[model samples]
Target: MERGNRIIYNQDGKIILQTGETTGDVSGHDTITELHYLDVEYGSIDYNKQHIESINPITKELVLKDIPVILTDEQKRLKALEEELSMLKEENKNRDSEIVNTAFEVVNMKLNNNI
Candidate 1:
């Protein structure tokens, strides 16, 4: 989907047409520098035929296709690592709290014994 400066090309890299917002006066208003869309502009794309595809890294282009989803190896590894790190952090916090409580209990026990 495209927005802002809505310009579509026909695979040949030629401008199909501009239709969203124009840089001109509208209803005797001031000249507009840009046109804003309330939501994503599909332009000439067929929503039914095409589905959301992975965006291109180099061109930042949104590709669409009606296909199944597959997670890459790197993506899976990253997810596993994130889960492991979260668990480790929770364990560390629990251990630290335990250590602090033990120290306090030892001090209280010694004072009570002397009395």
Candidate 2:
């Protein structure tokens, strides 16, 4: 069995979504029955949702009459930024813990006259 992808587009020539399906032999009639949209700029398909309006049998491409409202690039960037910020916050927490441990070690050394 081999996997296949169907690129779906809108009437305005903009991509809306895409779907993935696998093809099988006679005994294995497994196949993809969903639509996927192509991200022309990113050169990849968005598989987050199926937004197929129709299928163009002649061209073997899926079509959509209206594009779905998804997160814009700005929103995606913001999400990424938020994730990074969360990671940094966790890192800072670890750093703060390390600082506190170092301070404790210093205090113990001074009490033992090692400082």
Candidate 3:
């Protein structure tokens, strides 16, 4: 989420913070430029909290849990669209090849008939 922020400007003379790749130009009616992510340097404290259960008992269990990452709905939709586009492109390629082959065959047949 942190890497998804971009700066945007509005018609009302207000600056907006869009949390994604931003489109549109700074001045309206102009060509849109490719957007880039804003790099941010984060501050951090070099410290940690270390605690033991039962006043430092003979044995203790420290469980580390990691959250699972899942794809966003938009990402899923885009992936599906990409697959569909790829399939369409493949179909078009096959159709074009067939048309070319048919044309070649027709030309060859005409040449043979003339001979």
Task: State residue 86's C-alpha deviation in candidate 3, in Å.
Answer: 1.8
Candidate 2: C-alpha lDDT: 0.70
Candidate 1 C-alpha lDDT tens digits along 1-115? 2234556566689986665754544332345574432334757566656775666656657677864556699999999999999999998998989999999899999999984
Best by lDDT: 2
lDDT of each: 0.69, 0.70, 0.59
Task: Give lDDT for model 3.
Answer: 0.59
When summed lDDT is taken over every stretch of 10 residues in candidate 3, the lowest stretch is 50-59
Over the stretch 38-112, how does candidate 3's per-residue lDDT look in tens digits? 332343222233222222123333332334457799999999999999999998998989999999999999999
Ranking, lDDT, top scorer first: 2, 1, 3
lDDT (Cα, 0-100) at 32 in candidate 3: 51
Provide TM-scores for the models.
Answer: 0.29, 0.28, 0.27
* Residue 30 error, candidate 2, Å: 46
In candidate 3, stretches whose alpha carbon ends up further than 4 angstroms from where it belongs are: 1-69, 101-115
Stretches > 4 Å off in candidate 2:
1-70, 91-93, 111-115
Q: What is the lDDT of residue 83 in candidate 2?
A: 100
Q: RMSD of each candidate?
A: 16.0, 15.2, 20.8
